[model samples]
Target chain A: DAGVTQSPTHLIKTRGQHVTLRCSPISGHKSVSWYQQVLGQGPQFIFQYYEKEERGRGNFPDRFSARQFPNYSSELNVNALLLGDSALYLCASSLRLGGSSYNEQFFGPGTRLTVL
Target chain B: LAKTTQPISMDSYEGQEVNITCSHNNIATNDYITWYQQFPSQGPRFIIQGYKTKVTNEVASLFIPADRKSSTLSLPRVSLSDTAVYYCLVGEPLPNSGGYQKVTFGTGTKLQVIP
Candidate 1:
């Protein structure tokens, strides 16, 4: 089966502009999560959606938002972008939202956003 | 969330066993320990995970002692292809279990495998 897939591998936008990144999760997966990774740093969680509902959100600002579709695909949107927002946005998929077992998270190649 | 601390970098020769240890002094009873490997310009790949004791997969082994304050990831006969950043994450897998559960990654250990 195909793994998680993301769109627009590279993006360049001016400051204060808006951008949207898309992701399609693996088949049969129901949870999709978004993460941001800056250069030389580990990824930071942004938002997590399970079964088309927002399950958890990170410490990001209101400018960042995300929604999950019924098919388990997700889109991350950032408005009024800042130079600090320039980073690799990663999408991860899991089986469910809550449980004791820690299922492995499958990740996408990510969309590199460059804010000029 | 438990804060994890790991070595910043490590060097190993080909066909050598590599072990990376992470210290999480305040890990909760329900938190799970997970390890991820990330190559440059790519997303992180889950290597292995364990709650306590020992768990082994085809690729690596995770050894968590009874104290649960620390964990070790063991890679046997590693090669140059194994060079990557290894992250140790300590968090509860459940959503909204305690306020909001977010996975916090440390600086990670950058493993350089020389051929």
Candidate 2:
């Protein structure tokens, strides 16, 4: 089975520009989450969507947002990109939301965003 | 979310066993400990998760003591491919905590498996 997949494998944007990254979850998965990984650090949670509803959010700024689609796909939007926004954006999918062991999330290769 | 603390890095050789420990002194009752491994440019891959005691899988073993204040991830006979960053995450999902449950990952332990 195909794992979670992300689009626009690499992107370059300038300050003040907006960018949207896409992700398609593994078939039958119903939850998607986003994270940002800067160089030499662990991924930081951004947002999580389950069953087409916003289930959770992280300490990200208001400029970051995400939503899950009917097909279980998700989109992460970052507005007014800052130099600090230049990091790898990751998308992960789980069979469902919550603490079930079966709900383990599988992540994608991620989209490398470079803010110029 | 329970904050975790792990070594910044570790070194091991082929055919050697490597154990990385994480401390979460303030872990909540509902929080479960999960570990993830990540290669360069790729997202983290789930390694193993455990609530308490010992949990073993084909890849590694997770050992949690009764106190639940700390856990250890043991990799047996690690190879060069096992060189990656290992993260320890602690949290529960769902309607609790303002319905915004999320895992906060700290700087992971970078394991370098030398040939």
Candidate 3:
């Protein structure tokens, strides 16, 4: 089976612009999470959706939002992109989420978003 | 979530057993330990996880002592291909700390295996 898949392998946006990144979870998976990875830092959590409901949110700004579809696919939107937003946007999927050992997330190759 | 501290980098030769330890001095009672491995331009892959004692998988072994103050990830007979970044993560955020749970990752330890 294919792992989590993301779209637009690379994206370029200018400051003050908006960008939307997409993700498709693996079959039978019900959870999708979004993360932002800086060049030299670890991925920071942005949002998590389970069964098309917002399950968790990170310490990101209000400009960052996400939603899940009935098909379990997800989209992460960043409004008024700032220069500090340039990083690899990663999407992960799992069977479910509630912490513990059951939350092993399978990640995607990531969508490299570059804000100029 | 508990904070983790690991060596910035480590170097080992082929066919050698490598053990990387992580320190989480402020761990909580319900927190579990997890490990992840990642290569350049790729997403992180789960290595092993353990609550206490020793847990071994086909890839590596995770050893958590009784106190749970720290943990060690041991890779047996590691080769050059095993070179990558290893991340030690504690459990999700506490209940009172908001419901924004996530797989928190720190600046992982970079392992360079020499052939």
Candidate 4:
């Protein structure tokens, strides 16, 4: 089975522009989560969706939003982007929403976003 | 949420064992200790996880004391390929409302293995 998959492996956008990144979770997985990793730093959680419902949110601003679809795919959108928004956006998938099985999040290669 | 603290970096030679310790003084009862390995330009890969005592897997071992304030990840037989950043995260297994564990990652410990 494939691991989590992300789209637009790399992206470049101007400040104040909008960007949307996509993710397809592993087959049979029902939970998708988004994270941002700045250079030389570990990833920070953005949002998480389970069964098409928002379950958790990070410290990100209102400009950042994400949603999951019926098939368990997810999209992360960032509006009014700033240079500080440039980072690697990662998508992780788990089998379900709770317990130890869900704690081990399998991540995708990530979409590298560059806001200039 | 529990906050994690780890060393900024570590240096080791091939064929040696490496132990990276993480401190989570504020961890809660429902939180679990997890370790992840990340290479440059790549997403993190799960290494090991444990709530207490010791848990060993093919890739690494997780050691947790009774107090649960700290945990250690031990990598055996280091190699140049093992050079990467290791992250320790503490969070509940259940999602809050957004469907995730509300995880917070620290700066991580960068391990460099010499040949």
Taking all chains together, each candidate's TM-score versus the true structure is 0.96, 0.95, 0.94, 0.96
The residue-by-residue lDDT of candidate 3 on A1-116, one tens digit each, is 89999998999999999999999999999999999999878888899898999988889999999999999999999999999999999999988766434367889999998999
Colliding residue pairs in candidate 3? none
lDDT of 3 by residue, B30-83 (tens): 778999998887878888888899999998999998999999999999998999
Q: Which ten residues in a row have the lowest lDDT in candidate 3 chain A?
A: A96-105
Between candidates 1 and 4, which one is better according to lDDT? 1
Model 1 / residue A30 / CA error / Å? 0.8
- Model 4 scores a TM of 0.96
Docking class of 2: medium
Off-target runs (Cα >4 Å) in candidate 2 are A99-102, B96-100
- Candidate 2 has a TM-score of 0.95
**Cα deviation of B15, candidate 3, in Å:** 1.1
Can you write out model 2's per-residue Cα lDDT over A20-95, one digit (the tens) per residue?
Answer: 9999999999889999999999999999888998978888899998888999999999999999999999999987
Candidate 1 lDDT for residue B81: 97
Candidate 3's error at A46, in angstroms? 0.8
What TM-score is obtained for chain B in each of the predicted models? 0.93, 0.94, 0.92, 0.93
**Which regions of candidate 4 fall more than 4 Å away from where they truly are?**
A100-102, B93-99
lDDT of 1 by residue, A1-116 (tens): 99999999999999999999999999998889899999999999999888888878888999999999878899999999999999999999987666666667899999999999
lDDT of 3 at A3: 93
